[model samples]
Target: MIKITGEHHFAIDRTLFVFALDSEAGKVFNEKNKLVTGIGKVNAAMELTQEIQRNRPELIVNLGSAGSRSFGKGEVVCCTKFIQRDMDVRGLGFEKYETPLSGIPPVLEYGLLKEGLPQGICGTGDSFEMNHAETDYNIVDMEAYPLALIAMKKNIPFLCLKYISDDAGSEAAEDWAVQVHLASEAFNKILF
Candidate 1:
């Protein structure tokens, strides 16, 4: 009973426990069929919790693609902690996109680079980054934040499996499309 949620559907390598998201990127599926109305990352956690409350799963895995601020492509970094890098609250002079809490969760861990693949901490954002000049985070992506926040609210044990598709401050911008397949393939090899 593994359900997956992310922005893209075709990028995942294996489909054994997959629950494919639709165009708006939301759905519920068993091993046999799917049921999708209209949902996205913001509501995904509650949706999954409700679904799992009715029938609990062993665990939930949040799998997707991301942009790296400094790391190179083909790297498979796991997020020990993910901050909403786009959360704007600087009017009071507080740091924008600061971590919600002080310390990392004990359960929020990973076996990074276990397969001899490059891996590192993932810093999530709500935009596509083409360079790492201003941002000091390791990776950037849109959906991982909401997914992590929601999952935390539900007290669900989860893992973020991301592949670096774009390097924020390099020529990798043009190479993103060409490297996506390689990244996905790398993620598949490491995750499964």
Candidate 2:
């Protein structure tokens, strides 16, 4: 397990695994070729961008814990579509979640789907969603959108596996804290 904090780049395997935090990686992922990109979209985008520049990976696999009302806790699901949930440019005549002047679509349909696993639409934003009333996305995450967008632009295959840790409800913070540790194990079972 590698924590990507500084600008230094490390040698990684063909399939690069990415995690939002070290704790989310857990003990089982210690031997795997992984990068801990910290939290939030900017961190994820910067770290992933650097890694790709240093050594282009054959495929990028993002594994992290997410909040969802539609999925049960401890269940690992694939995310094929990503949304920048915080990008609201409605006042500028652009639609909500649409990046102004950027050609990228509001809903990014990029990510390799895993067979037998159910798929989800991830809404990536800076804030931890709690009691959010949005009905568009089934999953709420902090970093998956940028990772998916970057991979899509680079034409590299991307696979997002999110372990449902919370329900994006009033008790999301508490639930996530307790359930995040189990996400790594669930992902290990699915991918490793």
- Which candidate's lDDT is highest? 2
User: lDDT of all the models against the reference?
Assistant: 0.49, 0.88
Runs of candidate 1 with Cα error greater than 4 angstroms are 1-56, 98-119, 134-136, 170-173
lDDT of 2: 0.88
lDDT of 2 by residue, 1-192 (tens): 221224323344577889999989999778766789999999999999999998888778899999999999888889999999999999989988899999988898997777768999999999999987788899999999999999999998788999999999999999999999898878777665
Q: Tens-digit lDDT track for model 1 on 1-192?
A: 222333223222222221213321122223222223123444554555565566543444555556776666666766645656555556755566654353443123332123344445555554566655544356776555555565566665555667676776567657665665464346445543
> The CA-based lDDT of model 1 is what?
0.49
